[model samples]
Target: MAKRGAAQQLQTEVKTDEELEKFLARPGLLILEVYSEWCGPCLGVLGTLRRIKLEIGGENLHLAICRADTITALKRFYKRSEPTWLFATGGKAVSIFYGSDAPKLVAVIIRELEKTLQNASRPTYQIGDLQPIEAEVLRIKTEAIKKAERIEHEKQEKKRIDYLNRCTDVIMENLPDIGVTVFGPQVSRDMFKKLSEPAEHLKMQCKDRKYLEVFAKDFEIINYSCKNPLSDDVIDQLDGKELLVCFWKIDEASGPITHVLSTYAHELTKERVAPPDDEINVPHPIAPIISPIKVKFEVEIEDGEVWVEEISSEEEARKLAERKAAEKSKSATHLQDESRPKDQEGAEDDDEEEASEEEEAMQAVQPAFPNMALDIDLGLDDNIVSEEEMVEEEEEPPKPLTRIKRVKIPPIWVANNRRTHAALIYVFFRSQTSGFLPPDPPPEPPHVVMAFEAFKRDDVMEVVEASKEDVPQYGFFTNDTPGEAKLITNSIYKYDKLEEPSSSDRIVLKVNKVQSYTMLSLVQFEPTYCSNNVTSGRMDALKFFPEDYKTDEEIPPDAQKKQKKKKKTQDASGVDESPKLSTETAKSIDIAAGDENTEDSPKALEGEAQTPEVQAGETLITESPTVADPSAVPTEGAPAAGDGTDTQEPPKEEINADLIEAPAVDGAAAATPAAPTDPAPME
Candidate 1:
């Protein structure tokens, strides 16, 4: 059966009756055969059917062959011989052919197709068609598509919600705890609420901590342990389980909460360790020994006063020196020896050898002396001098004992703008030989004394008046020699007046010899105390009255009255002696002065004299009126005034004696005022 099925697949063959039915039910015409492969007639008809199918063309017809063994139902239904042919269209049998009659079958199929075409071309009864099944199928397909789309959207939404929930869980797990008791309940609640908002927003957007941190710019996460102790209730609720805890607080106003503290309870998990089962071998240790090594170094010795080459024996050094001397002598007289005879040269060599030997023997016997001249030989009697005699000649007589005056001037301290209340003086003395000898018991010890005095002024004259009671003497050792000694003492003064000193106040330090009272040195320094008070209110009164004086308390009443009277008299004398003109009188004077009329000049003078009533309180001068020199008067065009002295004056005009009024003196006396004898005429 499998072979027959395989053979049938090579050709277009139906495997079952149902497949044959489906083939016949197709829209186009189909021709099918039910055959048994073992039958000779079936084998012979297969080629004829294929030829007929080729003639008909596949587009308009479908040809199929079915094996009897594979499609038993179709063969039984047909009730045909070994090779039976059936023609069908639109699921109905049109013709059937038995046996291998290829020509008759083809002719019959052509005739049937022509009849069908004729029937199709004719105007057959037309019925309006409805495609309800197609419409139903389309509707079902669209519903299925919408269902799939809705499922996808739901899956995406579920995924988003699950992600959002996971993000929220992570944020909550990492959320820090605000200190409830430390920050107070209200503040802690507010901080917690602030922390929750960002977390909630991020959770809604399915964002993780990384994305949440992008928007949370105002806060930071600090890894620190909480300082607050957990309550018993919390511990009980936790059931001793290890859990991570975090603390948070708002870092700034209107900002997210920051994790300020965090802590975690560590799980106590014991890890077991198994001991090694393998045996180990231990090696013996060896100790190391360090041996010290002594290194010897050779140093070249150069001849010097302090550093000299060490000689094993003095005789060897002497011999070396003798050899060097002999070599030098031979080199020095080499030319002389060359010019001399050979016997003379040998004699000179023997003489030099004998002299070198003698010098070496003397050096070996002589004691070494520091700085001794090497050129002087002890062997030469003429050059030798006794050590005692040399010492006596070279030694210098002891220097004449001379006394040196030693004085020290210590730093002087002066108060600024204030009198010196107290001062410390230190005097150190040391003689020139004191540094070489012990500073004790001397033949003549000079007495040293220092005097401290405060002066009101910087001049030496003021030093005499300086309070002598405060000038203390600082004395050094009176009996012992004044070798090296120090005298330290303090001097204090009490001024009769407790007034602060000015910047110009000075202090004088004097060091004097006790016997002669000769002043060795005198230093004067201005006090610098309270310099800032110069411009203050304390000195403001001094600006006007620079001198200080005592105030008087008692005075006679008559003396007071006399002083007042004298002041009034002085004030009255200060007023101007010239009479003061009233406004109207001044205007009258100005008008009279401006008058061009020459005859009015006398009238104007007479008018001014007549105005005696205007000078009520004014004191007017009264003197003898001067008589005019008739010849000294200047005439018109005669030299103008101030040009040259006039030899002859203009003829004097006779004054009207009645018009000229006597000058008034404060309404008391009207007398003629003193005028010059030579009356300078007005130009």
Candidate 2:
């Protein structure tokens, strides 16, 4: 077994806004490294950090690492690949830098340490709003996470299939009398006395811990209360094998609320149908409830038995279990008596002794090759040896066998009447659970070797569909849900903005949502142009499900045209204002900053107040913060959403590398904590 280490390597772990505030409240200068899980920290700067710590000592400085993706205060800094260094004295950031340049890193550390020691600090501070991470680093090693999720999904599917399969077998095994529920034409007397409450037996037995344990193993059933959100129609549709696969996804997303609890808990009027009958422990009623029940008893033939012979569902289930166990026991005993004194019996007797030798040998030699034999099977002359081989360069990922083709098709949602004039920007493959289902008895799209194509919904440009077999891909370029897409165009916007607002309307586009099954278009948005927000955002294709790839490394022609269009947006310092985005990014943007009252065009972005300086298929999130009320904020305060007061954040500023390289120490870089944080962490 591998040796286990400490639970966390960081000297201080700040997981929340409150946690970070607490860390900042402590004395001394704190060096907080803005961190990301996707990329790695710079290992080369560790030795310099160690020497700086030895010289400066502990009380004058501190160090820490934080995940921008999780910690709310650092969220906007999510996904950065380059190392971001933030120097904080007290609660405010004193300086910031990017990249792991050793000289600059050391200088910043020592400079801040000395200032803290002398109590000579500046009056003003920079609220460090960190840079957004690059897309490529966000992808590295993530395949392992996706693979793990896919494996877990498969395990659940297997459980469901095993359950449903057994249900079918049980009904078949008890041919003529699986148990009858109806009063047939031949009988005035019913074997089962009708109870006013039908299915009460199931209601009672389902909750019984013992019964639940047994039933749960087969049906994938959990928390099956009377409050389950199964409508009559949903029940009728569940006759197919895909019921479990679809609902909990009913095909993975129940409108982004994947679980039943998330989808219906808000509507539920009661915490539980069978709430405890106590005055103080009262259950509060919410606004909504699960579908009303008007269950009609249906008579179906199970092995030609339209009548249930058993007195109760529980008693019947009990009998079935007992009968199965008895038969299995009898069979085992019979087999044991018949096979007495055989070689198998003697081998079974020696199992413990043989196993002991095997256990002892396992420590020294574990035979784990896929097709290799055990110790018993090894030849007399076989030898186990360890060989040291020269390390080879890592192999590059396999190139996509398919090309992204550009074709013209009228938009899938917006401007349907318009002829084909959009370009496909991206195509992703997702499992059915992601909530986008293909046609019932879906027509085969002639399987190709792993391939992808792109499309974007725009006023004018041509696009083509990239098809795959099982998964559904979502394009988050639109500002509305599936039903609200048509409500976007002036001629096309169908819903009233004041009366019926889209759930994701105006929200910063961080995630992708698929509304259309086909097409793409791209072009310049006229004053009347209704298109996806390309500024303040960029594309990111986070592929979900196993072997479902969204590899579009080569840029299509339309992308080049748009890239040229955004060229004038460059910074005055001659630095390229536009980010070097990876081709695979889905290019997301939040156009929600627009005012709703400003438009009657019906277009989703018609009221967009800001044209955004960063114009392209992507948005530069670092450029601006959405300020709800400027009057309420302090003169130097950063802008924030919702609240009148801006949420204080670290500023986005960089300390240039000053060429202050320290002499290198030869030992392997160790975990050396400075102040309270690990300034230079090994990747």
Per-candidate TM vs. native?
Answer: 0.16, 0.23
Compose the digit string of candidate 2's lDDT tens values, residues 257-326: 1132222322232333445457547655432222222223333343544443423567679999999999
Tens-place lDDT per residue, model 1, 1-683, is: 99677444434668776776677666555666666433313556567655655566445666777766666545442322335666666666655555576678778677766655555532221111113443465488668656755665677567655543443333333332122111111122223333344434322221111111111111111101122333333223333232222222323332322221111000011222334445534433332111112222244333442443334467688989999999999997996757878888789899999999999999987876857867865677877789998999889686543322222211111111100010000001112223332443332222222222233323422443353322222221111111112222111222213265322222322222234323322333322221123222122112211233222223456556676456435435553334555545544644643432222221113223423221212223222233365445443222323434433211112111212334444555332322222445663
After superposing candidate 2 on the true structure, give the runs of residues whose Cα lies further than 4 Å from its correct spot. 1-10, 126-683
Predicted structure 1, TM vs. truth:
0.16
Candidate 1, residue 95: how far the Cα is off, in Å? 1.4
lDDT of 1 at 483: 16
Highest TM-score scorer? 2
